[model samples]
Target: MIKKLAIDDLRPGMEVVQMSSSLWEHLPNLYTQPGPIKSEAHLKLMREQGYQHAFVEVEVPGEPLEKRLDAILADRMKDAPIKERVPFDKEIEVADRAYKSAMNHAHRLINDAKMGRKVDFEGTVETVDGIVNSAVRNPDTLLCLSKLAQYDDYTYGHCINVSAIAVVFGEFLGLSRDELTRLGVAGMMHDLGKTAVPERIINKRARLSSAEFEEIKRHPQYGYDILKRQGDVPEDVLEAVRDHHEKFNGKGYPANRHRSDTSALARIISLADVYDALTSDRSYKDAILPNKALAIMYGMRDQAFDPLEVQLFIKCLGIFPSGSLVKLSTGFYGVVYESNPNLPLMPKIKIILDQDLRPIPSELVDLAARQAVGDENLEILECADPTDYRINLKPYLTRTR
Candidate 1:
């Protein structure tokens, strides 16, 4: 049987396949070079090398891939039909409040850093903890808030979104709450050094002069310095705060640490920071479609991000992420309000545009359920930028209890 085996769980004789997800179980037999794990020594070597998990053909019998996640994450995965897992509607209100609070805190911290006021690392604990709890309860709700809730200031909003994304991705990776908290804090503070950079260069719409760009490159060190002055923060969080910009290829700034040298939390935050930055609307550019951003990141793997981490991140968020405007096979336009991580290609999109691509009343369609019922005609044809259609996903994302 094909199974998703964590590095620690890999035993001798299991053939490792390069498939996605720790949402693992029995998947299709994909022979990505048919390398069965050799022995206990090899497994130890793999773990020592920082391998997370592997898709492998093993002797153990297991549930099908699609069936396993629903059972394991019944209380955690987005929209798993389990009653104990609070519905997204009930959870989203609390999530929205948490997001706003985190943004407000981010704004204050960044401004304090600018004014040379000492940062109270303790101040961030509550907000980060709230986000982690929500992620543990309903990751999709926290992610939707990240997707839809935009603060007036980009700097603050970006910080909070990165934090939220990191928490959700960390949960998918099976990180403990304490580990997620540190990762979330790292994501929130990663760009605090940008506060030191002159506002003109940071917000410039035109190409930056080489000297100006060099100054921009120093933000990592500047961030490290700012956080170092304020003691009591965890060392790992501080390291991630400084190294989130480091490239997987050892080409990134400050320390220029190789991918293997970087902490896992930093790597997780790096993926979140880049994805949020790419998909976000900025003074420098318009937001790219989620699909486009994912495609770009996929190509940059090993060069920009850890190759396996990138693949897993893409798997967790899905090809068409929540809040994405998408098109269906029936010639309708919709916003993806929720993603199915196990089957990322399918999501529950709220249809709001008709066959003629004109505005229509909202109608939510769960593509997975439709497909499960053999409704082959209903499927996502493509993902699009919501800005292109002037579609506001907020209204469609809410549902009456």
Candidate 2:
């Protein structure tokens, strides 16, 4: 008989069988090789493959594994109450308020540009400056900004993404707080010229005709003019906004030159803009996966992006960004809610469904430590698309009052 060991008792010599809702597997980790299982399916697949010595985690009442997982959760909750373990409610409230405020401000700023009436462009800059300054001082604010993507409009969404990316990029590049705020301003304003474009062209759902494209291309110039007219905006800010699209490969429009000619802020903004745009759904295509987008950026290194900057961007955003949906080997899907900064890829996931894609009572899985404990048998099959899963996370993550 295989000896049963508590997860904490798992060490580098014990053998056990692991099972979950959709999987069963055998692993040496329970006794010999110690590590958390990487995914849900590994347990089941290993079991099917004839491995007998494995330990698996399941929620079934009365099962030894279920009891183990429950004991672990109970112990964890006892040590750090559920309120502290996952403060999703409080965080969501803060995020919702910030997003709404930023959306209103962004929409007004864009509308102001559409009307050709100079609203306080400087004020928009000031707001970005304030946000960046706060984020630099308190990293948690960065988490709040990530939630801004929940808003739908491109203008507001892009602004929030830009601001967040700029702050992160600034941190990566070791820029001072003052410089970070300025870089963020440049990012937020990089597409300011879009406001001058005709709404039909701006909001066109289809590919632009050449004439329309050419007209659209003029927005950079339009943005530069707008900034120049705005009293006393820094020259660097104007340059970054106007030149972000101009690539080093001379392939980008408006002025195709090597990225070496671009200002540092422009270089940083260029990478951020492309990453956000690629990860976001556009008129032409649905949003691509962030990892896939990062791979594409790697392909464009040196030609379209600064190679170092691209690497840094990946480092900053991690293998899986927050808010992404992922799949476990068990075939269940979950949304990534929080990631420990040190381990950007593995985060605390709130699983809403089980393998085979059936809704279940929800639970949080801390992929980093839970799987690694005694289940090398577990593994991630692949990333799942949350949009396809019909996951409405707001209700679970948010508190109305």
Candidate 3:
């Protein structure tokens, strides 16, 4: 009998054959590989498991006819971990530095406004520009840091998240490095007016009363006033920060600016802000998954969002982003780990369970190329929310290299 092993149980010198998820349990013998398959075999096993799949310790043969499999394994053992090259820690350090610097100026301005003291708008602009330049010069560093949601204060965290997201979007839009930096600054300062609002309304855990909501709407004007006094911010950035909420249908507040009145960057910032807000957990509402949030935003395109910009956002992030849950055609649940830019719709995934939600040994799957021919039914079925299945993504999302 071929002893059944979970996906992680796979190791060096293990002989195995590829089988569909359904067949893995019922007909173990149906899939069999000759003994002691090395490195290429491990890669094959991962593909056989699913698109862009992975497992532990299986060494299949390499391409280009290596001299010895043992030598290759020895070489790999000497190589550094992937995370080391990615430098996540360094990225976090940079983001923390930027955040701390920006927050100091922001909070001080808030305090001044609260005390009825004149605001130092130039100082705030300078702080925002400093952070934006740091991110634009080293985009990947900030992107790595974006994975952290819980830092000191939720407000400051939100600000950093919004800035990171805007930079990502700006990159996708093909903005130049300098342009991305400016746009990022605009994103960081987008909510500057919120400082003028009372903490009671800003941090309210419950639904806001109508009057409170009305008060909340005035933050845009407050932000505009602060920016206007400073005189350093570009017109487009100021407009985006102040009028992001305005809609095409003229139902938005403050001035109810229409689509025709809003600038392109303002529209993009608005869309990014709303998308991030919906996907993030908040005081009064549970977080929605990115896929569902995208769907909701798609539904609102043309009314609240620019239809073209929404489509571009979708293109930038893919159908299911990294850290999303999905269901495969073979009736298995998996988490998307990385998306191949060359094949956006098909990403590398790690299988976690079967159709009934029972835990199974994890496997890696790459949807772009099927592991075995005539296995069309094993293709991806659809995207799913982990929340719908009560699956927590934190562990997988935080998995180290």
Q: Which stretches of candidate 2 lie over 4 Å from their true place?
A: 1-92, 137-148, 340-344, 356-362, 371-374, 399-401
- Candidate 2 steric clashes: 36
Give the top-scoring candidate (lDDT): 1
Answer with 1 or 3, whichever has the higher lDDT.
1
In model 3, the worst 10-residue window by lDDT is: 51-60
Candidate of highest TM-score:
1
CA lDDT, every model vs. true structure: 0.76, 0.62, 0.61
Candidate 1 has a TM-score of: 0.77
RMSD of candidate 2 to the true fold?
Answer: 23.8
- Candidate 1: the clashing residue pairs are none
Question: Which residue window of length 10 is worst by lDDT in model 1?
Answer: 21-30
TM-score of each: 0.77, 0.69, 0.62
lDDT (10s digit) by residue, model 3, range 347-386? 6677888899987777767776654354455656777766
What lDDT is obtained when candidate 1 is compared to the true structure?
A: 0.76
Count of backbone clashes for each model? 0, 36, 19
Would you list the rank order by lDDT, best first?
1, 2, 3
